[model samples]
Target: MESWELGEWYGEFLDALNRHDLEAVRSLIDPGVRRAHLPRGGEAWIADLGEFFHAFPDWRWKRIQLVIEDDRIAAHLRGSGTHSGHYRDIAPTRRHVNVAEFAIYRVTNGRIAEFSGSSDAELRAQLA
Candidate 1:
């Protein structure tokens, strides 16, 4: 896909995330998508994303920027939500939190096939 198309695809993906539409998110990701950062080390990227949203029902993902080059897209996301549910091994605290994340996605056929992300751990700690 062209760079513009990749940007659009990522935009929609972020929109779906902001809306907390699981189905839309599922539809946009490839079944074989891999997540490089997970408590369990590595797992399906979608599964990790689901875990995040499940833990924070009100989670909002805002795309600060999107850069597409070759077949990879880098997304800078700023998000905030309340910790009302369990996240991975993080127990429920019902605390409000804000996090900034940077993610790099490898796209193929207009779908996200692989991803790596990191967030501000200090922010999470502060909120918790």
Candidate 2:
């Protein structure tokens, strides 16, 4: 796909995530997508993503920017959610936090095949 198309697709994926539309999210992600940030990767990451939304059912993702190239898309996103559920290894603190995250996704056949990203430490501090 073209770079613009890839960027649009990534935007839609982010929309699905922000909306907590699991079915839409499933449609965008390849069943075997590899997620390098997770321990077991692939399905594990998918599961973790679902859990994240479960914990932060009201999570909102605001797009800061998106850069698309050949078959990759990088998204700079800012998100805010209430700590209503456990996230990662962090227990629920019932606090609200705004987080800034950057994600690079490798797209194949219009599906996200791989993803790697990091969250901003400053954002984490704000939450704390």
Candidate 3:
């Protein structure tokens, strides 16, 4: 896909996520999508994301920029939320956080086929 097309596609995917629409998210990702650091596929991703939203409730991601090349798109994003519930062993502190995140996604057949990125350490630090 052209860079602009990929950008629009990615924007729609992010819109689904920000809306917390798991069904839409599922439709946007391949069933066999590969996760670079996770053990399983798209289902695992959906579950993990659900847990994150449970913790933050109002978490939102804003796209800062995108770099597209061939079938891959690199995204620079800013995510922000209030800690209103449990996350792992951390209890809610009612603290709000905004952190930068970098992610790369590989698209295949117009859907996300692979993903690799993290904001774990930075997110943890801010929540602490």
Q: List the residue pairs that clash in candidate 1.
A: none
State the number of backbone clashes in model 2. Answer: 0
- Stretches of candidate 2 above 4 Å error? 39-42, 119-128
- Candidate 2 residue 13 Cα shift, in angstroms, is 0.4
Comparing 2 and 3 on TM-score, the stronger one: 3
Q: What is the TM-score of each candidate against the true structure?
A: 0.84, 0.86, 0.95
Query: How many clashes (backbone N, Cα, C below 3 Å) per candidate?
Result: 0, 0, 0
lDDT of 1 by residue, 1-128 (tens): 88998888888988888988777888887777776754321235556677888888898988888888989999888889988877766788888887788999898876777888895575568555
Better of 1 and 3 by lDDT: 3
Instruction: Give candidate 2's whole-model lDDT.
Output: 0.80
**Residue 23 lDDT in model 3?**
89
lDDT of 1: 0.79
lDDT of 3 by residue, 5-89 (tens): 9999999999999999988999888888888868567888888888889999999999998999999999999999999999878
TM-score rank order: 3, 2, 1
Worst 10 residues of 3 by lDDT: 36-45
User: Best TM-score goes to which candidate?
Assistant: 3
**Candidate 1 segments whose C-alpha is farther than 4 A from its true place:** 37-43
